[model samples]
Target: MATLTPCFLRIFAVLQLAACSFPEEPGPLISAPAEVVRRYPVFVGRAHRSYTRQEPLYIQTVLKVNRTLYIGARDDLYRVELDHVSGDEMFYSKKRTWESNKNDIRICRMKGKHEECRNYIKVLLSHDGGLFVCGTNAFNPLCANYTRDTLELVGEPISGMARCPYDPKHANVALFAEGSLFTGTVTDFLAIDAVIYRSLGESPALRTIKHDSKWFREPYFVSAVEWGPHIYFFFREMAMEFNYLEKVMVSRVARVCKGDLGGSQRVLERQWTSFLKARLNCSIPGDSHFYFNLLQSTSPIIRMQGRDVILGVFSTPSNSIPGSAVCAFDMQQLARVFEGRFKEQKSPESIWTPVPDEQVPKPRPGGCAVQGSRFSSSNSLPDEVLNFIKTHPLMDEAVPLLGHRPWIVKTMVRYQLNTMVVDTEAGPHRNRTVVFLGSTRGTVLKFLITPSPENPYSNTNTFLEELEGYNPERCGDDSVQARQPLSLTLDKPSHTLLLAFHSCVVRVPVARCQLHSRCMKNCIASRDPYCGWTKGSTCSLLRPGTRLPFVQDVEYGNTSHLGDCDGEFVNLFGM
Candidate 1:
């Protein structure tokens, strides 16, 4: 399980004790709100009249639940509720906070030629106790299920073509699993085929192969997570194994096998017998690396250091200065590069090899078989393993990056980091790690990791603050929600941080240290692992396993704990 040649020299090189390194140009020490003194107060997700009446509500999907908040917007659908915890906004609380009366049977937009009907609610899943919603209804993609405390509509209306994405600004990913829903989007209306599908399953509907440009070359999906019997997803295509006259793109991470059931109506019929796809290396390491290659946003499969990790949000379009990065990947290095080797590419004029472990084929083509197990599913494999997975679905190593670089890395800072979340509070000793990026001009940084004192298995970022979330001169003329981008939502049971902006959704504070540090050296220079400094009581929030006398260095801020605040908390700092 641990052998890939020093994990590829622990993934590329540049040692001080190598295994990962990068910071050739890192910036952001602290920013805005007068150097992060943070008073903490934002909370706006509903002014309703659709973002304060008469057109301007662009929030395309949010889903908090528990102090509720559903919100999906464009042709509307909402349900906000937050009756307490100071960050108020209980617009009709006991009345259940509703707005979704949607029954939507538009049946693919009933023959309208003036095609601009506008629905765009774009998939917002919740699972189990109901609330699955999906929409682009004007372009005719349906899907329903609501009522998490009366948002209504609970049965009938399902056929959201490749599971939503008829172009409400295409970017998809759905997920439900075992109760089947799994999507990756783009089934057509001239959106150009691209799919990963799987639709309402338990047996019939599997996708990915129709119009296959060698398995999706125009992708853009970004974000999907299930891990285990596999689900993965995360995208940014167009590098069918590189051919460049300038096209390249590549930032993938595919997988599929929530018990795949395809092949056997002539090799991959309803397709995707365990999809495949690799390449997500995110460069910056070494004798010329640099890469970043466009993967805009991913993070939901967290739990670092103890493993699992996800965190992406790369960028690379440089025509003269444009770059971004945050990288993290490592689900056992993507299951050891999807269990190693399988890239072939034989005829578009030969040359991208790797298929020979004596012509490799057995119980592996992205496995997940355990029903009676004996090659238990892709409809009973072995036609030479479905013809070696229809000419190999690409994968010959290239998953790298656990610490080959990128915890954060901008470049001349021209904005465009669209969305990421990763949180784990309560630590002066254990659970602490945080990172919340999101920028496309409205800003909201907040890093604070620490482990690499030169590879303690790598990691070391600390930007700490740049929180000016969504401004454009304070929405004058509603500034079209500032070109609609910036979508984070980590409501970890109310440690709060909703932040949307395309129709507005703001609730901050995943730590301004109990709403503005009352001292202990400004709560240890705001290294904020959710704040500390307690010994005589002041800068708060240290909860999990607190034996009292707090102080916090969280991973390595170590300001010598300010020599224990020298005497009666030096007046415990003030008011």
Candidate 2:
């Protein structure tokens, strides 16, 4: 046993932070497109509420189910059909969903003082042939079910204490998995106590330790998704490991097994037994690593290269670094980090250290119980193991990014990249991952990530032209999208990019391949997964539709690497 001095500890942390993930020389920064494309027009659609109100419209959540967009606003829920837009599909102030949209279902109708009781709809999850809706009912949270067919409230309203946030503005996550509802949100009225709670399930209800800063310290949950047997939650919280002058926010990925029954009623009564979290690293590896520590949003787990991948959108939400990044992670990588050693701090004054492997008990502490074992379930596990897990849930090593560097990094930009969505399409060689980033300025940026030509293990990212101030066909220049927080979800079934703003939900095509058809280099440089340069002299999807062959150079902007695009592109450039 050795005790580390304060000076030595500081040096250890500094070196560990720098030499953490990169075991060898890191790859070069990914290259941008040779020519920058700007302001690709987007087909924007604004949902029209049935009627106008006095207060400013504060749109909260836009969930797409089947072909309907279930939009949750401050006081109403408007259901807009995607393919059946009748009236003007523009962002007009007067044309509400009454004439253009399909259904205008009001989910929030609260009666209270406008303090914290304003019925701001927050959580909207489809469950059990209906909609499990919850709202911030003037500080008291309530949840109810609406019939899926008619979209009418059917069930009685019940308490949503741990299922939804008390403040409508707080960042929260609601996930419905295995016929259960799970949430990461604050429970109290003042919005101080944050929790990861599971309710309305066949299994016993479980939650994080209450008032325990070790579990959640001022956490702002980004999103949650079910991967394999575990529910992964991405969030940014105050780091409990470091005690600096100013509190440092660290990105985290927390995991909880879906089948976890609460621990023994004696030691850990209704608390989760399979709960663990690890720091997520989205940094540029070099002499000095620059970190995007605030995780804003995460894309759904999409399969790529025979592995499940999650693309996270991280930014300096604290406004310290005016930059943002998009990082991809393999789900298996995070599973390994959780299975690694556990970290613990002896006291407030002691340094956070990893517990020796020999000290860990049998069957593992934070793992789902086996069907046949000495301790069949967490409730039957030994008190010693439960106590050990109760204190130490954080992993020692941070989860490294998929590659050593971020796929896309934008520093000193005017707008923070708050949200992103990922679309994977078949490329000439393999599957190409396209990334779409939404900014605070109500714009969407597109890019693609492909394997590097020099090193297959490495990756190269290409940025498409920004979707600058171009108006949609129907919408005028004076649209209603304000400079508010944005959220992005890619509807793969419909091939639509669903961008949610404060005022409306805008739907646009995933890729504008035709915009780059004029120039062969530009089409290849676009790097959009849904697009390709065809031999018939046009840009289109990679298919045999009267086109001889498709020319794609997603790897690098150069057509030579594609092996067959040598002379075909020369004629396009008048060479």
Candidate 3:
């Protein structure tokens, strides 16, 4: 064998160290091929929570069990009941407001003067069969419970001493399995410490999760919770001033075991261990100012197939990439990461790739890229393609579109937004997950994993193509266009999925809809057109004297109303 030179030996050493030090290329499991299986429009209605001119940063799914769905919109809560055979019947709770009485004269004439009236509702399921909700009213924290069946207020409103010190804009709550609750308080640009408490029979013992201002940087903004053998808390760290320019922010998923908290203390004394932490790399270049404020109202955690823990998130890029992206790490990965055995060594930023046509179950006619990268294929591109982009920096400056490839160009277009997994079976699909992503202009997508024969960890691509079946152009209807999904829940028993979104409640069968005509006709004739109903269908509207099948009552912005279908048909017919 020829002897290696000293320079070559040193170079080889450096390469070996780099390989060992960096996180192993996320293994084959991370890069397994994936494609869209279906994409369907979900209608969530137009009601939203807004503060001043700032759009609400987060929306949360409070409880999803059976066919009942509960959602949190800032300070209010909404519920939807879905009929396995029909569709969705929706109703919302009254907007609970806060008032303060300062003068006796005014108190005599009025019940009381409200200092503040807010509609934010953060909810938790109590281990003791109660539904606990907490939010800021006026400036104070208020807690309430509801009967499991009637959802009627179970007891007098319990008030917490903790006050929302922020802009009345971004306060939220999370609960642990042990019945402990955490509330994040934000003031102006700063997120204060999380207020912690445990419900002791009737009252809650409150304490604060504290850290030195200098060490922790931004205070905790509670984003998610996990309950199993232990309790985990997830939060977002405020972006540093320099990071603001690059549109980078760090998100952390941390946890404290249930065994750690057993006493009267409101907050746990132990430090949280991070299961997974990532620097959110936005897709849109130069839009660093567009921070994802999802911490206040999004549930990044969900129990899949009844047992597995599924975590999801949406990170927006401000630069050239013009969309929000979705990605997920499985519970096993989370456990390993939490144990400090796993660390992310890949680029803090996510890479995007286009969905191959053959991989898509129901291929769309137009070319489009899904916002994710294959861990295994990261180095598969031709050297020339990489070199060309490297040499021609101007081409790199142009944000790549989804289908335009040389893979690197396509990678630049996607960003991760939100992800969820619905397990069809325990063995192969055990770790299988579904990712829902939102684009910059508000297009939502759905993708799933297709099993692969070559690799145990690697899966073939299969997009959830049915979701896009209701094409507005093909159907000559706009109602079928996919809208931004606010929240998603899976009904395991019935194999049904419900999407809560900005426009309407959309239901897609785990199996195809057998009653396609009834489903499409009802959707179109309803005229509210929130749900995607097929076009050119023989759906008939109820006559003027006919009683409507269902009535929708909504409570939002501190007001409530019962909307009738009398004139709704006119709007549906374009009359």
Using TM-score as the measure, the top candidate is 2
lDDT of 3 at 161: 37
| Superposed model 2: Cα runs more than 4 Å off | 1-55, 86-116, 317-319, 426-430, 469-481, 492-494, 514-575
Error of 3 at 491 (Å): 2.3
TM per prediction: 0.35, 0.81, 0.50
Q: Pick the lDDT winner.
A: 2
Q: Which of 2 and 3 is the better model by lDDT?
A: 2
lDDT digits (tens) for residues 372-482 of candidate 1: 777666777877777776668889889988878887887656676878787765454546677888877767788877777667657877787776765443333235346
lDDT of 1: 0.70
Superior by lDDT: candidate 1 or candidate 2: 2
| Root-mean-square deviation per candidate | 19.3, 7.6, 19.9
* Candidate 1's TM-score: 0.35
Off by over 4 Å in 1: 1-71, 77-120, 123-160, 163-206, 209-253, 256-266, 269-274, 277-328, 339-433, 436-448, 452-455, 458-504, 509-518, 529-575
Computed on alpha carbons, the lDDT of every model, listed in order, comes to 0.70, 0.72, 0.37
Give per-residue lDDT, candidate 2, residue 208.
Answer: 93
